[model samples]
Target chain A: MAIYSYDGTFMGLMSLIGFLEDKQINPVAICDKNDLVTDLFEEQEDIKTDEKRARELIGRIVDHICEPAFDRIVYGFLSQINGFEMAIFNYLHLGLTAGENVERLAGDRRVAPLRRLSLRVGREVHRLKGFVRFAQLADGVYYAQIRPDHDVLPLLAPHFVQRFADQHWVLHDLNRSRAAMYDTHQCEIVILAAADSLCFAENESHFRDSWRRYFQTIAIAERKNRRLQQQFMPRRYWPYLTEMAERVR
Target chain B: MILADSAKYDVSCASSGTFRQGRANTLGNATYSGICHSFAADGRCISLLKILMTNICIYDCRYCINRRSNDIRRTLFTPAEIADLTIGFYRRNYIEGLFLSSGIVKSPNDTMELFIHTLKLLRHRYRFNGYIHVKIIPGASAELVHQIGFLADRLSVNIELPSRQSLAKLAPDKTKESIIVPMRQMAGEIEMYKMEKKKYRHSPNFSPSGQSTQMIIAATPESDYDILRLSEHLYRKMNLKRVYYSAYVAVNHDALLPANPRPQLIREHRLYQADWLLRFYGYQSHEIVSESHPQLSENYDPKVNWALHHLDFFPIEIHSADYEDLLRVPGIGMRSAQKIVFHRRAANLSRQDLRRLGIVYKRAQHFITINGRFEGGQSSLLHSLLSERKIERARQLHFDFNDAPSAVQPSITGEL
Candidate 1:
């Protein structure tokens, strides 16, 4: 049995899938470079990221399977779950063999786990779109920080670009040390340091105080259900939230 | 703090069903499916910055802490302050928009003028294109209401109580005609604007999200039947997008009002479920609640109650039943019904297929049959099994705030 290892990028994983298809070799397992377990008896192959091969695989998936199904594959890859690369590879394998009708096979064990993981990634993206709080910097740039479980910076750029089109803003994902910066017109991703030294605009605290005041005051005392609150906006996200920051501090 | 805490009793914080794309040089956009920025300790959604212009009031309502007689701190936000705050918050993506409600200061017209002024500054000066929902004081003039309607995305006039008699008893200053006239005028203006948009593409949108109203439940002795019927009337006649039900939280001590009143959350939840049935599931108010059965069953959900009562419609063939019939079943939701319709074309759906379609088979198995074979056991056994699940759910409904994790402690003292 052959074990294929690649760099933990979506492009690298896609290239490995492409290589597997070209070589007609079904791997026993696919692991990220960090997650590789050394086994003396097993054969291991290291796959490098090939942009052309990755693009070809994406084109094939979009043409053979549905477009949304391709989106699910991307979302599933973004989820960063263990063994998800192989899960997505198996799902694509099944989809290619079964043709367009593979999208309807929800009950199939091979496709269901990938679908569920992609759904989770989609839900996290949707939640972060609402939960992201931007604090204006001294330079008039709206700076916000998030620590999402998955790599959602790529998914969130287009939304903020459409919504806050006229403003310069930076959405930093602290977990990944990556930021999506939009300078009123275009958006680009860059490596950003931890945002501890940024100077906020004057009166930023006043608006944040008012928001915290509003958040606190708007909850009915008689129906206080912190469980439900934590269920929707989990406690782990409270530190970055302006309204919940005071409590955490 | 005082304004938002007092306004907390007014539950209508949804910022959905309106689509406004961000324009060039504009600040923000509004989505049709609203985004909840956060959830409060009470488990309520914090979508809009729901606040009041001022907490001081002239009218003395029995259920209000902000009544004329109540001794509470009074503060008002200036039009510029409101505009600045809304724009600042919008730029940060902290809220979908603003839900601006206010207490009647000197008169309805005076208070409405303040709202209109604030809206003007936010719209014209700030160039804000986000969702804005403004409340119309009941006695505000038609011209003022129309002017505000054109500026705001949505407008609402709170019919605080369900019936005219209840309004007279609890809130003596508000009359049924005074509250409803603005609603009717706004509805007419909305219809006219839709027609005008067709004629002239650049016709300014007039309350493009339409109007909605809130009714305080359990404040009076009105049953669920009265509330649902009134909601139906509002939806059918006034063209209301939503009818919010706010469970009464006793804030003031009055001889007429009940002392230490409990917020009927279960009843409110049931009413919202029944309202969904009325709006989406093709069920009428009277069908869900009748004069004979004036209240929804506290033990079971309204859908299950309806399904149990109408056993004659049971054993619906999974393949043969149409979309409407599928929705009528107890455990089948709207999405599952649509999924079944889409899936059955490719293959015959079995019990496993129904389960995979996300149907609650524990409840649906009693009502549905696959290939004319009943997977559920005897009728009595199925009933007992369903009842057991209902009782388990009912037990879980008593949410103790103390049991919540320490991360979400009640830090705000504004709530009464």
Candidate 2:
């Protein structure tokens, strides 16, 4: 399987699909590998930044395929952080094989990567449904922060922005070094001083304290599934869970 | 002819329903204002003000975070605070509406009362008419439920588990009663309003947009078959708008729940896929699941699974299969199924033409043939292919992004 590399952005990935259209060369599989390895002779390659190539890909996609199809394939590659080349190829292959008959092609084998990514992100969003915490800044920014595995910050912003849009708020995605900052008119990205610049509000600690106590009280010891718990919320995220840390101590 | 389909949808993304559309000189994220800067799967924008009313819940459902015993940060929002916040958001156009769910604080009625009050203040006092989706606590009093409908646009009560036995084991505080009673009553109220409006031409609308419910899968062993049965009942009996299947994730290491938090999303996907069948496909749960496979098939979708299990339904002459029979084919979805029905009315359909009607040749080819030309896979497929269904748990996602994998990793308590 030859791995293809792109600029590692959504548009760049789309541009790669543009390459596929331009050359009709569908690579073995497509994905965006954060860690790119150039296998000198093991693979035939293309770097997708040329404007002409990018335009062709976008043009072919919009003209032939529906707009929604590209969105999923691109988001899947980004979310799973899958092999971008494979991800791209699989997406195009699924679309071409299925063509305008998009709905029926929903669960085809080729599109499994994207479907899995959707389900994975779906589960994470549900888990974090309860985990999002707000820290009232000294300056009254009402800052909340998260460090999700995928670039979930972009995914999660609309929820908080809609809920907290009335107030100036900053939801910092520390992993990607960006924040979804909702101002008076629009929400944009901001980089914090560090995670430390943010502080819990006057009532925030009380809330966290209450939450810690609540978390400890709910578990049925006999039903404890450490492995299952670890699997859903990798122990990595525990550092930021108020209740879990308090209970451990 | 593969129409190039690249997929992207961050699952954690929600399109905001903040009603920020008509705010005058005031900052507000429109109730539906979370302008889906990006549309995720299910074909909706990925912008919405999604959050809980407060994380403080008196009910300790084993699957939930707001439960009393869960060691998580908890917060409470006063009506004034939420109203002020919503107005600020409305001015800014940051969201569409508020998705506020809460733990059972004090009692179901109390929590529901608080939620209703917050919504009321957002509406009457602040004169805000954005989208407000309040959680109707399952065991909440009838009056509270009624008041909630009057205040909010959409109300939902999560049917967290499929069966009562499962609910008791994992979410001890919740029962089938605590969950379904409100749904039943809310359904009645909605029907009442619908009837009154139909007859009198005008009446107080109760949940005009209607009620919705959610189920947590993989928290218990109820098969997708069973889950679909419950969903079918909720749809038919409860008259729900949507029955959301939130794949279960392990927030706590609850012995009663799955040891791992990752939900069987393929199962969840199968359920949703089946759900579309029931709601739109003119099929029933019993039609899909049987004594043979009480649980849904892990490999293929319910439709494809059904088509494969019963070859008799196969090759329904694409040219002759009635609209309903056409739908029975594995790869034919709502659009394609209808397309074939419509196009065939005009002329005789052909094998080459099935693809034009939107049938995925691989999955549908065997089950359907336009000119009696079969395109089924040659392989005797084994059980469903299992790509890692390892759901990323709450443990990983619910953290301070600032808590990097460094010496400065913040403690799990959401502290700096």
Candidate 3:
């Protein structure tokens, strides 16, 4: 009957899970430090992050379970859902105990929540890959902004790096105040301020107007299903889209 | 906007089935799993910058709004202008690639030459490695077609009407031979290039994504059976990647065309479903629609209708049935069937196991028996239940005009 709290980073969480497994002690709950509720009778443990220990734990999981299970754990952490740390800890506990056959227990109640949360995060990552719209800055860098429901900036870097290998781009996650900057050779994540003073290229609005005109013209009058359109590209993403900027005007 | 609105009648905007890895010093690459950058209000995927190169036409096709007789403003984008626009849009990730089509300006060769110039500028000058789909004007010479095919990823030649008689009545300028000859040539060249690539590792790919064609539905008297058979022939004989069905939009009024045209979206949807059956489900066209039944029933889907007509195939044992047999059962798609085969090897499956595999057990319960026990009703009761579900689904498919807001409606002039 003990609760373990970590520093809310993925490395910190993995280190705490590694320490618990080494001690062979199961905690009643695992959460971030901010989510801890003080109880007078319950015992609480504060775990510090160890980079080497976290790397070794991730390598062990990849060796014992599967690579996809490792991805699932990372996605679940990125989901930032309440009580997701415990769900991931339980999923890893089952995987380690069940050996290589843990994937067969996917339908089990203990592992289903982790799968669902990971799927939701994966869907948001896929949508942002398509929904991200870049505007040319005066310095010849492609600049785009997104306000996603989950922290998906880490998941979007490898994709854009492969696709836009010849140009410099910056993708800002406005919700989290983080940005992924790519310099045609490497990508780095940094904290960025709001882009109120950023100056765009002179012809940026002209190209945006052309895209808006094309978007408005291609839809057929005979069959208009705005509900379906909104279902795929929700209104929350409209602020950054060049085609939707005309509607605001 | 004028070019895109006029080009909306053409419905072959697919950006999938091609894989080109991103290279250094290049802007983008194409993946097998196509990315839809946006969706139109018509519920269709917007994967490409679908626009016409020029809207001024020499032919007077009765169903087209850009015919010579129409009183509409005309516009033409030069090769440099088109090249710049496509590059600008691609950099912003607003589109997967460019879908370039044009109306006949002075002659077929002249129009095709313009398309070739634009493709050359995009592929050579700008060094764009993304997906590009170009339309082949009918009656274009072989030299021009080959040059265009070498640069573009996919090519298409629209068989505007289904039959020759319909073409003669609507578009007198186009003949059946003019369209079919170039299609046959492209197919032959594609095969030749494939063989050449095997011999030489770096032989240039010819239409690596393959060619596709479009047919307007409800404009002519062609039945669904005719369209399915034509699609079957194109897939087997010409090796087309896709066959798009566009419901006829009556933008122009003429005596030869229908006075009041209705866009039969359900029929178009059903045709796509049947097309999937032909391409992926390993079902022949004759099995789905025969000469006796020349049309698909609007009440039930083609797969369910086939299952209902052949009642002897029901009640298959879930444990012993083959993969193809499992596919024949309702609610078992390609992925679920694969999952069933994979999961059953580890454990004997039950009704709960089937549900966990993502099978729609409500529809599948009537067709499968778990461990030699049937949970479905008698034949008459089962038939009634399936029919009731079908009727409910059909009613839900109809869109209510009153429920939609007025702001979303298209203007009376058909301009956005």
Candidate 4:
């Protein structure tokens, strides 16, 4: 069985899709070069990042199919993280094999694993944005700690730049111990320990008091479903939710 | 995972289309803007990023997707990752806000620590001022739920099942004691926040958006009436934000559990209608179902059914019926009923006016009178009218389910 590999990018996955469309070849698996590699398939095809090829492939899919579906297939391929390039190749192989009656033919057996991957990646990306809580350091630099599902810190810097375009802050993806520090003048990624990172602002407590109070007020009590609550806002995440610490022992 | 996680929070609990704006650019347009899908794995849908801090579990519930014995792939995120991702998605406008949930990875304290770290990082670290909803891990120490209430825009915990016996059968690791105690603790703190806010302007309010919970349907033998009755009590007693219904999917096969996939979408749909009636419409759980009425008709909606059961109230003159009377009319939803009240202040409404107000005169005409005249022929024909209405509703719901992208949802706990 042949292994189709990519340069571990979105376009790379598309190029593989292009290959599946034109040929009847069914690659046994897809893998990404970034994660650990397996010795199952000795033969590997790298979907080179050709600007023209990638564009034409994506355009072809969009011209005929849903753009989001095409994107999902690519992202689903990425979520494999391990042997992703191989998975993408297989997924595309299965998708192309289904051809027109695609959704019906593939069903849960092929579609679920891929969609689940895209969803997993998308959900983690969204949750980290909400759960990443920062505190003030003595140096006037804002510092925060987080433990993420993936090595997501690298994928998250541009957003901080866009949102807090004017502010100075430090966001440490605590799981990886690497941080993105946006100083007023420049932004750099840094790493720090939980012990060395404790710092505060003059009104840090005051600001938290306001935030904590606000958090308490908005939730409608008439709808308290603990299981639903735990499913979304799991207990493990409480350490990072403020106010819990405010009244902390 | 976000779909799975939506089961954790009630805020993202919607399953329909938004108001239809023409596709200025796209091919199709939803009448409603923010209806999401249900969890197929759990029959919950909504465009919510439902996920866990970590999937490791201390208590293995038999019905849960993240239970310990299940070998489903598990993952956890750093606070930075949760915060960063939320902002990025928010900017992309793919989501409304963050709905953060986690499995107990370690001790309750340790688990809560990570939760706070992520929420704080999202707020303080990322400076992400957006919709953030979190859960009050029930077993954590006292100050935990109290503090969580302060940080979270909305807070919640799951009832899981309606009764303690059911929960015990499927989820031995969880206890009503551990669950209800923290929930009560958070409720008290939030209530106190309101009290303090009035007295001391400086006192911060806790859980400002409020708290909500989900009850898993089909996990137990609890009937719709039983669920609605329980929902009524929760709403009145707990002052809950929303009582979410997560139709149970058989995640594990246990002797104590059935492989119930979910309330068929219709069942889920009916419950939502029943829930809306309880919350918005002036209908009591008893008015819809009782010891005499053990279940919703499933054929006619609870409202029409209510109208059928009580004929004395029918032929209610549009110009004469009070707000409560007008609310009882089939096809006259809360919005329509409110519209009628406002419109009637200027002029006396007639049968023509009810049709103009977007009230489905087909279902309501039999039960309501216009000024002094009732246009709906006879009460006997009303029976067929009721059954026909059921067919129409089923068709609409089917069209809704069929038209919606199936890859993202199943037709149960959620869809939008």
Model 4, runs deviating above 4 Å: A1-249, B1-11, B14-48, B199-202, B261-263, B379-416
| Local accuracy of candidate 4 as per-residue lDDT tens digits, B30-82 | 21223231112232333444556777777788877677888766676777766
- Which candidate do you rate higher for lDDT, 1 or 4? 1
DockQ leaderboard ranking: 1, 3, 2, 4
Model 1 misplaced stretches (Cα beyond 4 Å): A5-8, A19-25, A33-40, A45-50, A97-100, B195-201, B378-416
Better of 2 and 4 by lDDT: 4
**lDDT leader:** 1
For model 3, residues A1-249, the per-residue Cα lDDT tens digits are 699999999999999999988888899988888878897888999999999899999998999988888999999999999888888988999888775566665566668789889999999998888889999999999999999999999999888887888999999999899999999889999999886688999999899888888888899978999889898888888888777755556
Error of 2 at A37 (Å): 47
Evaluate all candidate structures by whole-model CA lDDT and list the values in order: 0.86, 0.61, 0.85, 0.62
TM-score of each: 0.91, 0.54, 0.91, 0.55
Total clashing pairs in model 4: 140
What are the candidates' C-alpha RMSDs? 7.4, 15.4, 7.3, 20.1
Worst 10 residues of 3 chain B by lDDT: B403-412
Task: Score candidate 1 by DockQ.
Answer: 0.65
lDDT of 2: 0.61
Cα distance off (Å), candidate 1, residue B19: 2.0
DockQ of each: 0.65, 0.04, 0.61, 0.01
- Judged by DockQ cut-offs, is candidate 1 incorrect, acceptable, medium or high? medium
Q: What is the TM-score of chain A alone in each candidate?
A: 0.94, 0.75, 0.95, 0.66
After superposition, candidate 2 runs with Cα above 4 Å error? A1-249, B1-45, B347-353, B371-416
* Model 3 per-residue lDDT tens digits across residues B326-390: 88888788888888777676457778778877898877887788889988654333334345665
Candidate 1's residue-wise lDDT over B113-166, tens digit each? 999999999989988888899999999999999899988988999999999999
